[model samples]
Structure formats: structure tokens, C-alpha cells
Target: MALMITDECINCDVCEPECPNHAISMGEEYYQIEPSKCTECVGHFDEPQCAMLCPVACIPVNPAHVETRETLMQKYVRLTQTAA
Candidate 1:
């Protein structure tokens, strides 16, 4: 599943750089995760980097964009391929 940053985010500026996929960006209020670029860090790491590094622990699975591991892996593959 793609992860999302809740309003609880403190704008700590930590999560954005930790994301390998470059999916995290400054939103109107807080950092936002782009679901299209989010793979739960499947292709890059064993766990989500943003969630792991977030100081406030505000990142959470996006219930609106629930996806299986297979789907996330596919997304990772596609992203890598596109970047290449």
C-alpha cells in the first residue's frame, strides 16, 4: 500500500530526502506522498524509508489506495524501468 502523511506531520524535512522514490513533496500543509511513485520502498528496501525515518510517526498506509505486495513490486519495476 502507498503511504500517506497525516496532518500530524511537523514539517521536519526528514521524510522527503529519505524517500528513495522521490515520492515525498511539500504539500499545502505538510509533506505529501505520491501514490504513483510509492511502492512502500519494495524495490529499494525491506521497509518504507519515509515511515522509518519520520520523526513524528505520522506516515501510514493509504486506505484509499490499498494495494498488495505484488502490485507494489510491479509499481517499483515500472518506475525503475521508466527512469532508466
Candidate 2:
């Protein structure tokens, strides 16, 4: 599943750089995760880098964008292909 940044985000600015997909960005109030670009690091890492590096643990799976691991891997492949 894609991940999301909650209101609990402290805006520490750590997660943004950690995201391999560049899905995290500064929102009007805090950091936000773009579901379209979020593959939860399925293609780049074993775990979500943003959530792993976030100090406040504000990143979590997006319930609205729930997806299986295989689906996430597919998204990751698509994203990488597009970038290439």
C-alpha cells in the first residue's frame, strides 16, 4: 500500500529526502505523500524509507489507497520505467 504523512508530522524534513520515489513533499501544512508516486519503496528497498527514517513516526499506510505487495511492485516497475 501507498504511505501517507499524517498531521502528526513534525516537518523535520527528514522523510522527504529519504523517499526514493520522491513521493514526499512539503504540503500547505506539512509533508504529504503522493499516492500515485508512492510505491512504499517496493522497488528500491525492503521497507519504506520515509517511514523508517521519520523521527516522529508520522508516516503510515494510506487506507484509501490500500494495495497488495504485488500491486505495489507493479507500480514501482511502472514508475521506474517512466523515469527511465
Candidate 3:
């Protein structure tokens, strides 16, 4: 599943850069993870970068957009599908 930012977020700007997929962005008053872009680090890292660097620990799994490894992989494939 993708990650999400809750209202508990302090808007500390700690999670933005940690996202390898560039899925996290500064929302109106919190950080938001784009479901279409997030893979929970499936194709990038062993763990979710936002959670690792988040100071407030406001980032959590996006249950509304739950997806399996194969689905996440497919998302990753489309995200970086451009020819080299």
C-alpha cells in the first residue's frame, strides 16, 4: 500500500526529500503522498524513506489505496518506463 500523511503532521518538511518516488508533497497544512506515485519503496528501497526520516511520524500506510507487491511493481514500471 501507499503511504499517507495524517492531520497529526507538523508540516516539518522532513518527509519530502526522503521520498525516492517524489510522491510526497507539501499540502495545504500537511504532507501528502500521491497514491498513483507511491510504491512504498517497493522498487526503490528496502524501507519507506518518508517513515524513516519523518520527525513527527505522521506518515502511515494509505489503506484506502492498498496494493500488493505486484501492483506496486507495475506502478513502478510505469513510473520509470521511459526508454534509456
Candidate 1: residue 2 Cα off by (Å)? 0.4
Please provide, for model 2 over 1-56, each residue's C-alpha lDDT reduced to its tens digit, 9 standing for 90 to 100. 88999999999999988889999899999999999999999989998999899888
C-alpha TM-score for every candidate: 0.97, 0.97, 0.90
lDDT of 1 by residue, 1-84 (tens): 999999999999999998889999999999999999999999899999899888889999999999999999999999999999
Name the 10 consecutive residues with the lowest summed lDDT in model 3. 75-84
* Residue 66 of model 3, lDDT score: 92
Q: Model 2 segments beyond 4 Å from truth?
A: none
TM value for model 1: 0.97
The 10-residue segment of model 2 with minimum total lDDT is 51-60
Off by over 4 Å in 1: none
Clashing pairs in 3: none
Candidate 3: lDDT over CA atoms?
0.86
How much does candidate 2 score in TM-score?
0.97
Task: Estimate candidate 1's alpha-carbon lDDT, on a 0 to 1 scale.
Answer: 0.94
User: What is the Cα-based lDDT of residue 18 in candidate 2?
Assistant: 88
lDDT of 1 at 40: 96
